[model samples]
Target: MKTYTCQCGTPLFFGNRQCVECGLDAGWCDVCSETAAVSPEGTCVSCGTSVVPCANRTTYDVCNCFVDASLAEPGTLCRSCGMTTMVPDTSLPANVRRWALLEAAKRRLLYDFRTVGYPDDQLTALPPLAFRFLSDTPDKHVVTGHANGVITINTSEADPVHRESTRQQFGEPHRTLIGHMRHETGHFFWMREIEGRRDAEATRLFGDADANPYAETMKQYYEQGPPEDWNEQFISTYAASHPWEDFAETYAFYLDMRAVLDTLRWNAPEQVQDLGDDLPSMLATYCSAGIVLNEINRTMGLTDLVPEVVPPAVVSKLQFVHDVFESLRTGVVSQS
Candidate 1:
């Protein structure tokens, strides 16, 4: 989550479509790894790759990513949108906006993945990653989860009113489109990168993913709730529902903390440090910054921006996640 700037020096963000200072069209340059100005024809200035704005952007204003025309098939989607296997029926008026929100979150997740060296090609091959944004209809109930590398999300979660009500019903303290994308993609990556690797050690930390019947475990979890002492070891109550979920929830928090820390390092370098080797120090920096952010939200009559406390046990889980990410990134083991 590095801060980007317009060629003219105006600070930009990952999702910016236009530079406010230069009034030039802006987009993410996959080659340059930053938001840069796009020519009227949508070419990447640095790479000289002939690009086109994603189809979803042109048709539905849901994406800002550019597809490399030379690499993609004619009339095909950009890297992010191409991963979508299904979308809600566009004939329904509300579905368009909901799908847009979902796409925005997906693109953010993809951007973070790429920043961390998980390229789209590597992820979408073999046990490929894909998405289905579906709406619950009279005839079908859309459940959100990942299976066989495909992630499905219910579009109803995009509507704030509906989302808030459901969050309250489930007694969840925090819920967002981005959170759901990060959490579910965790499942896909776990299956793809760690599931059967002879040397992978996630099973030792999170418990065997295949040790129990997932459906029955979750059914009982929903009916009886997580163990009363769940907070002692799990990041969230839902995470205690099953081993796979424990991994996903911890993985999602790792992404969350890393993104926030990156932003802090960019904007407040004096207060943060480049202590990448010290996980405990990084978490302390995040918590210190989060307290200030929570105060700002309080002043605005809003909820805390980051509410969860990272207990010692949860920090150990996050450290394991970091080790796995490092192994995946560098193709070397971080620890025995």
Candidate 2:
């Protein structure tokens, strides 16, 4: 995660409503590529209204969610906030804190999405994206990942202990708010790329999405183990279940590299900074930087935090994903 400083030089929270040193208002706006200057009235392009100020502003630290409605016509709510199809049942006893944690983590996810050039309404001028946050039983509400242009987040994920336990059970090396964003956005991109564009063709290349995504296949896998040689190609054993899973994992891997490259470009000296903006150069930089990060983690008595290696087969898949985004960025691919 990148550190942000207020214009006044005081460090501010990622979702800060006001800067302490200069009294300037600020909120992260990914489209603008900087911390947006929040108008004193609390208006911002991201949220479209003045944030509700903390009642205990003097005593407690909190992120600002202000929006100023009076200054001008209200824009849609912030991209992440707007996607909330459901909030936790506030009426329930233990839900209030859970909801708060979910919202806070969500803001961090949105920050990553916007910063990494994924489309948010603020960046694309599209209709607001939507999301649902709900609770369910382990037997009843299986959270199958899918994106039909809208997102659904199981509210249980808000529990830190539950998330950490699942991370350990799954043997995942890294997991966090930003990691979820990278993973789910993979589903979102699949919806964008596969929708109405030769679905049959994709099925031939990828696989049949028509297969019951929620099926006994997963139950069988959990009881048994992933197929043999799963590690030879797939990032995780679960990814080998279906092609859609493959695409999502592959997309997440590409996002990991993309963000690493951006961090490199920001930190490198100007003399060596002009690496060509192509998949090969970016991939090379990602590998080089990844080695340094791995070594540093070991120095600190931690394991290689990102254990997955990018083999040749995975690199080919990543290049296809990168080329698709490059075409989108350059307008070489028409939206129609």
Candidate 3:
């Protein structure tokens, strides 16, 4: 979430398609790993490199990311937009808006992935990561989940009223477009980084992902509901459904903590300046910041900004995630 310098020295943000101060076109440069002013003629103003604007930006006014022009082929998308193999039918105006929201959240997720030093395309063995947005029709209902690296999101989840209603229906403390993106992405990463390679350790922390059939576990979970002490052991009631969910939920929370800590680093440097000893430093910073954020939300009569409690067990699971990403970042573990 760190702001970048526009070509005109204005502050550039992730979603900027045009610099507000200078009126120059702006987009994220994949090579520079920053959002900056770029000409519509396919030139990065900041880096002096040729880059192609994402087609979605021009056609639908949805994207603000660019692809390196030298590497881009006909119809090539930017890093984030490229992963999307399907988008909801854009003929409907509502579907277009949903796609916009999903793309915005996705950019944040991809930014976090890059910030954590994940390799862009290193997992050759696993199915390629992709996103598919689908809208529910009369005969078919699209479920939001992940399989074989494909993350499907129901367009209805992007509607504010629908999302809030569903949140209350599920008894979730917090839910939103980014939350859904982060959560389903958790499933994809588990398949990519942990499935067979680190299952033993992951199981030790979050239980066995293969202990029971996922369908059966999910069916039983909705039928019986989470345990009374679910909050003590898991981040959310839904997380208590199964171990894969446990891992995905924990991973999603880990992403949330990292993203928040990044903002904290900018606003209150003293609070999250150093990620000393990794997870412990992060936890300490998060606990300190969450207390203030939660109180501020309470004062405003808003939902708690950081509602999920970081219990001892949850911290252990988060520690495993930190280690996994750290290993990726430092090349301490072989991705291949």
- Give per-residue CA lDDT, model 3, range 32-58, as digits (tens): 888888876768887888988887877
Q: Candidates' lDDT values, in order?
A: 0.80, 0.61, 0.85
CA lDDT, candidate 2, residue 14: 62
Estimate TM-scores for all models: 0.92, 0.76, 0.94
Candidate 1 structure quality by residue, lDDT tens digits, 1-336:
777766688887878878898787777765555667776776776467777667777788777777676776656677678789999999887999999899889878876785465645668687688999999999999999999989999999999999999989988877899999999988887777677862246766777767768989999999999999988889899899998899899888878877777777778887686545457877888788889989999999988877878888888878877767767777887763
- Listing every candidate in turn, what is its Cα RMSD in Å to the true structure after a full C-alpha superposition? 2.2, 5.0, 2.4
Residue ranges of candidate 3 with Cα displaced over 4 Å = 39-42, 123-125, 333-336
Higher-TM-score candidate of 1 and 2: 1
> Top model by lDDT, which number?
3
Rank candidates, TM-score, best first.
3, 1, 2
